[model samples]
Target: MKAVWLAVGLLVASAASAQDYAESDGAMLRFLDKLTSVTGDVTLSRGQAAQFGRLVVRLDSCRYPVGNPASDASAHLTILDDATQTDLFNGWMLASSPALSALDHPRYDVWVLSCILPEAATEAVEGE
Candidate 1:
């Protein structure tokens, strides 16, 4: 009976971890989509606008464990105008607050933005 119960507990824990990872990934993806849309334009300014661009790039390159929380997840974004080799903006996201570990799903929320200069905007941009 003891062994059976132990096995059951482990199984449950494993399942919970998997669920958390999936939820976190989904949330992050959604957030990325939004960020991309916002950065698609070059009207952003130097402060917050630049930060959002960095966030989109960072999130796009993110990779998480199958059953891990995004507590340590961070992102950065950068934009460039193809015509000019100028970097418009850059930003980063770090989990400053205590984020929930995935027991069932991700619980942390992150946002970021960044923008590129008109000169760099002409370059073929790639973010990861």
Candidate 2:
């Protein structure tokens, strides 16, 4: 099952690479505490990191189709388990296809929801 998911993730990553995207200022992500059924969202700027419970989540980069928020959102993330100081996930995760590359934690679920595009992106769209 893990291998299959890895294969799917690679395919999705390759497909996404073919598109033109604009860098976003940050990303909006969500997490679920599987054991407690608690859910929450976090807004993280690129290069920012946040901690939830024993997990430390970092936003590396965020991007979307230029001027198209309704389109796909992709974010590069690095998540670590503070309890063990080991990485849980370190890759790009797609908002439209979260299952393609997901965190394999036993008690937590994290995924990208959308990107917080920069003001420059809005202006660029308006200029066009």
Best model number under TM-score: 2
**Candidate 2 residue runs with Cα over 4 Å from true position:** 1-19, 120-128
- All candidates: CA RMSD in angstroms? 15.3, 7.3
Give the per-residue lDDT of model 2 (tens digit) for 45-121.
98999988788999999989874654789999999999899999999999999999999999999999999867777
Model 1 scores a C-alpha lDDT of: 0.33
Runs with alpha carbons beyond 4 Å of true place in candidate 1: 1-60, 63-68, 81-85, 90-92, 95-128
* Model 2 residue 101 CA deviation in Å: 0.6
lDDT of candidate 1 over 51-127, digit per residue (tens) = 22333222222222332232343334343433454543344443332132111112212342222212222232322
